[model samples]
Target: MKQGFVKVAAATPDIRVADVWHNCEEIRKLLSEAEKEGAKVIVFPELCLTGYTCQDLFTQDILLKEARRALERIAQQTKNSGSLVFVGMPLAVDGELYNVAAALNDGRILGFTTKTFLTNYGEFYEMRQFRQGPEKARVISYEGQEIWFGPQLLYQAEEMNELIVSAEICEDVWSPVPPSIQAAREGAVILVNCSASDETVGKDSYRQELIKGQSARLMAGYVYANAGDGESTTDLVFGGHNIIAENGTILKEARRFTNEMIISEIDISRMLGERRKNTTFQTAKERNLPRISFTVNLEETRLTRRFGANPFVPQNMEERAKRCEEILMIQAMGLKKRLLHTNSKTAVVGISGGLDSTLALLVTAKAFDMAGKKRKDIIAVTMPCFGTTDRTYHNACLMSEKLGATLREVPIADAVRTHFRDIGHDEDVHDVTYENAQARERTQVLMDIANQEMGMVIGTGDMSELALGWATYNGDHMSMYGVNASVPKTLVIHLVKYYADTCEDAELRAVLLDVLDTPVSPELLPPKDGEIAQKTEDLVGPYELHDFYLYYVLRFGFEPGKIYRLAKIAFEEQYDDETILKWLRTFYRRFFTQQFKRSCLPDGPKIGTVALSPRGDWRMPSDACAAVWMKDLENLTFNKTGGYSL
Candidate 1:
């Protein structure tokens, strides 16, 4: 599998109770189906070769013999499948019956991972028919084949080293210590569970959460295949709730009672990266378990997993509102502490009527409220320069007055012209110097005012701007404290909107809503017909795409190529491959080259997992070259079908 993505499936095929031949045929059909879909790893429910509802039939000698025969048949059926398959069955070892998951690949039985925990409480009578497996792994002869049979068998792909997998049958995962935990510690990136957990009143939700929690705890991919309909409903009904999760997120889940197959590509590289970053997740001190090597065709896995376009913001309305509230509180609390610690008399904010400044001002007001300081002491400065629009300026002044902050209107056009003349620069010639002069001039004004009033200049530059190095150095970049440093541009929009929707003051709400609608601009260049010119997105690419790139690049250390692939999937409908590739290249170039700006960032609260604060999460050499990353993007060639190939 390329990119460390292995397509895995959890299939729950309908089975007949105690009918080994019928169950074997169903398993073969589902195996073929999953293989046809290019699944490299597939899992089935526990004891599917002979249904879990067999009761006394599980102990019959004929049933056990037929199950072994069915196992051999399933193994033979995988000759041309080129997939590592795990199917459940019952086996008789040393005259003791044990339920186990047999690992099969390329026409042979690789190993058998027996269920370690037997369920005996409540409606489960697994202990009656099966005993616990061995504490330690051991090799055994089954029909002249020396197969590894234990709970600690790890099936590793010979092609992709990161595609190591392990299995635990039904009750083992429910136990305090799952075998998969040790399996993960011993270098298993993917864990599969062959489960026959029947449905109860609220068990499905609990089961889903359990599987998600286990994957999150171990930092591995988890695939669970449960028993479905067609099994005799002798008191317990099988729902066949198949699920595939990767690192706490469910990638694909089968509907209950459908007995369907759920498949998704698990990013093994991401999991490995997370594990490497997490220092507390220690591996086993000693490696004693057997490692079984399996082979699969090395091809690019067609990803079925969905990557959210906005990783910083939640998708659900309720969750997003809650997240916005929590983030706002975090911002306010951080500012509140800075204010109290410094005993500052005022919090100065440059209100531009843009999302970042508006959020900064809101946070300042909240911090003032939290610190029991007078709101009038918070100076909200609106610096009108060449690019200031009537709409934005109006909103800025109104919002400041409504929030009870002392509004100050400072017109800086003449000041910028004087500075240009001093530098022997033409006032008419529009260039970076022209734009940066206005920015630096505004910053100079804010800093001097803060110094005069014993206040702190709250930085309004967001995480997106810092990531792209979009802010002017020593201008908007330098502040005493930055409340929105970790907040991304895409998230800033939502946060402002959330405040507008929740605030009780009608004038402030209207101003916020209008500010949210205004185009994001620095207002450094001259305006055209009173409308704002120099739209940021037209020059720097869309913030949504940049934010996505930033999240994956910093959060997971994903390579540029992988990030491109995920971006294509996330924004497939909105952006084409060439556009995504263009923006992605720009993102990497700016991110690497702009480290100098982030190397000396001011103190800011880290709100999310991804941050660029130099004193905290990220530290890099300012001169580090992005050639390697750019080269990865260069390798991606657009094809006629509008897809890219590396």
Candidate 2:
């Protein structure tokens, strides 16, 4: 598998009970279908060679003989398929019957992984006909060929070292210590379960959750294939419920009562990166598990997995609203603790009627409420300079009055001009110095007012600005406490809207709604015809794209090429390839060059997994080079017609 992505499938073939030849034919057909779809690893239901419903007939010599022949035929059929297949059957080893999942590839039986935990309770009587497999692996003669037979067989791909696979039967996973646990600790990235779980009322949900939880716990990909229709429904009905999951998220799930094959590409590199980050996931001290290697042609897998355009914000409205509420409470609580510890009597917030400032003011009010302080003691200041717009100024004053916070207006145009004259800079030259001077003057006003009022100046810059180093150093960047430090720009809009929708005061809600509708800008440059002239997105690209790049880069540590591929898929409908690549390059350059600002960031709470807290989740050196990452992007060629090639 190339790029550590291998397409895998979980197939539930329809088969008759005790009909070995028919079951083999169905398995071969499904296997061929999966092969055509470019699946490198395929798994089938347990005991499919002879259906799990074959209760007493399992002891018959004719059925066992036919099953052996069927296994050979399946193995022969996979000679040119180039897919590693796992099928189930009852095998006789050393005069004892064992329910086993046989691993076949390239006309050979690579290994046989037997069921470690037999299901003897409830409707299952597997212990009655089969013995539990041995804990240690051993070579056994099967049909004149020596095959590794045990419960701890690992199927590793020679092409990609991270594409290590392991198998376990149905009941084994249900047990407390699943064989997959050891397999994962021993370096298995993908775990396949050959399950024959019969259908019952409400059992499917539990089964699905169990598979998801196991994948999450082991930090590996899981493929589950269950038996389906065509089995003799003498006492129970098996509904083919196939599922493919990676690291707790289910990529594909087949509907019940319909024999379906579910296919999805597993991201082995992501799982390995997660493992590398998690300190608790320790590797086994004794690496004694038998490793069975298989060869497959390496190629980039066609991704069918869905990557959400907005990773920080949830897609579902209900879930998004819930998340927004929880995040607000978390931000408020963090600020509340800081205020209580500092014993401050007031909290000062610079209100610009912009998204970040609006959110900061709301959080400050919430913190005051949580700390049992008066809202009047919360100072809301609006600093108007040359770039101040009438609409934003009006909204700022109205919102402060409606929230019952003491509002103050500080016009800094005169102070900035005096400073400009002292520095011998032209007053008409609107450049970086002109913009940063206004920002620093506003910060000075806020800080001095906080000191005069016995309060703390709450920072308004969000995580997105911090990532791109968009905030002026020691200007809007410096504050006593940053409430929205970990929040991205994409999520800030949603959080403010959530509050507006839930607030009881109609006037306050109206102002918040207006603020959400206003364009994102820093208002550093002079206005054009009294309208805002400096748009942040127009210069730094869309925050949505930058946030997407930030998430993949920081959360998973994915390479630039891989992140670009995922971005193209996620934003295909909204942005062209050239636009995405352009912004992506900008994001990388800014993120690398701006680390010095983040190196000495103020204290803030981490709201999500992707945070830039220097002392916390991210600890990158300020002087790290971006040449290697930039070179990767430069190698990609993009055409004018929204197409790209690497």
Candidate 3:
């Protein structure tokens, strides 16, 4: 597998009722196709060895025996193919027939996972011919081969240690408690389901939701292979809705009614890390019936799934709008609670014509409105320093008036010059002090106004600034409440665009679109031809890359090398290899060093999986060293020959 990715497939092969030999040929063809696509693990639909719709024909002795022989032949055919494969059929154990997903690896039956729940409702009549399988496992001799079989089996990969595969049947997943849930809890990073769900109206949507929700609930990779076309249409039709999902998101899905294979490369390490962090998942594993044994040497598989450049924002417009609205509500509700509890009469925010400040101001307006207070009670302060441009100053004033908030401008050029003189800082040489002075002055003005007006100084810094520790300590970092504290810099742009899209007033929308277009800057240096002179990305690297690193690091707990690998794929069109590497190095250094800033972070609401709130999402010690993480990242640059394959 490439890095920790294990390419897996959920396939539905053409089948004929009660024709085990013909079915085996179809299985071989599909399996070979999956192996060619670098799928390390492959799954066929339930009763694929003999079509699920075989019905009473399932009682035929010759058909059952041929199904067993077909299983053996398929295992032998895939011995050299290197992938671990799952095929469903009937297995007789202790003189009782049980529906089973037979696990095969290297020409042998590694084990068999029996269906935990049998459906007798509506269309299923498996109970008439097959007994419900054992919940616990035991070695059983079948056709002179002893194999472990049960619902508790866990297929561990020796080659890819992080990769684990486990299986359950169709009805098992529909139960209140699915066996895959416990299987996932038991360290199986991927849960495969061999299903024979018949087609019905709106069934695909429900199936899609089930697969996605199961992945989310288990926090693991899920591959669902349902019965396909060509199954005996005696009373039901199965439109193969094969799916592959990771962590609740569908990565790939095959169109129903077509004989298709769904393939996806899942990050086993990420799923493993997620399971590690969730105490409940680990605890569930401990108490659930002991895990049964099935081991496979994971064949080396290449990744085919493409990661997104912007992980924070959705690509779909309708979904993006919904997400934007949800995020805005989260920010507003968080501020509203703080305001209500503190009994603050007003909220004071510095309006900078910049995106971060604009979003914070927008959220503040909503919070006040929800609290049944007048928008005028919001003290919107504009503090211009030495480098302030007329454009931003006027825009800030205009925004305050249009939003119906109290507009107050406090220019701090002379006061900051006096402070610089006191501190022996050269006014001509504008450096850290020069930049931080403006931010602190702006914060100071808002704080004093908030105090005087009996209001809260709502923080304007978003999650991105907090992640890279770009904001000055005790400057923009301190506030009564942070509205956009959990929002990433990448998402901030989309939120502005979302507001622009929804604005009723063309003039206000025009201003918002311009604000969205504006390069993120503090406007703390003299304007160059009436434009921003101090762009943030030029100094600290792109927030896109930093936010990418932060999400994988904090949310998935991915190693530096893994994050670097995925980033290259996500931003291949935008950033060259060396440029991405350089920025990745910078991200690791800043993120680890900035733990001190995050360790004492002010109160904020966590809107996403990635958050740096000291007391909540993040609890790392400020003094923790970055040496190990840096060294790993540096190693990637040295061995830069990887990812040469297009």
Q: Give lDDT tens digits, candidate 2, residues 431-475.
A: 999999999999999999999998899999999999999999999
Model 1 deviation from the true structure expressed as Cα RMSD, one decimal place: 1.0
Candidates 1 and 3 compared: the better one by lDDT is: 1
RMSD of 3: 2.2
Tell me the tens digit of each residue's lDDT in model 1 across 1-646.
6788889999988788988999999998999899989999999999999998899888799999999988989999889677999999999998899899999999999998988999999988888889899998888999998989888798888877778999999888898988998899999999999999998999999999999999999999999999999877879899999989989999999999888999998889999999999998898989878999998899878887788999999999999999999999999999999999998998899988888999999999998998899999999999998899999989999999999999998898999999999999998889999999999999999999999999999999999999999999999998999999999999999999999999999888988988888888898888899898889999999999999999998999999999998899999999989899999989999999999999999999999999999888899999999999999999998788978878
lDDT of 3 by residue, 457-548 (tens): 99889888887788888888888888888899999898888887887877778778778877888887888887788899998898899888
TM-score of 1: 0.99
TM-score of each: 0.99, 0.99, 0.95
Better of 1 and 3 by TM-score: 1
Instruction: Write down the lDDT of every candidate, Cα atoms only.
Output: 0.92, 0.92, 0.84
Ranking by lDDT: 2, 1, 3
Q: Candidate 1 at 43: error in angstroms? A: 0.5
Residue 364, candidate 2: Cα error in Å is 1.3
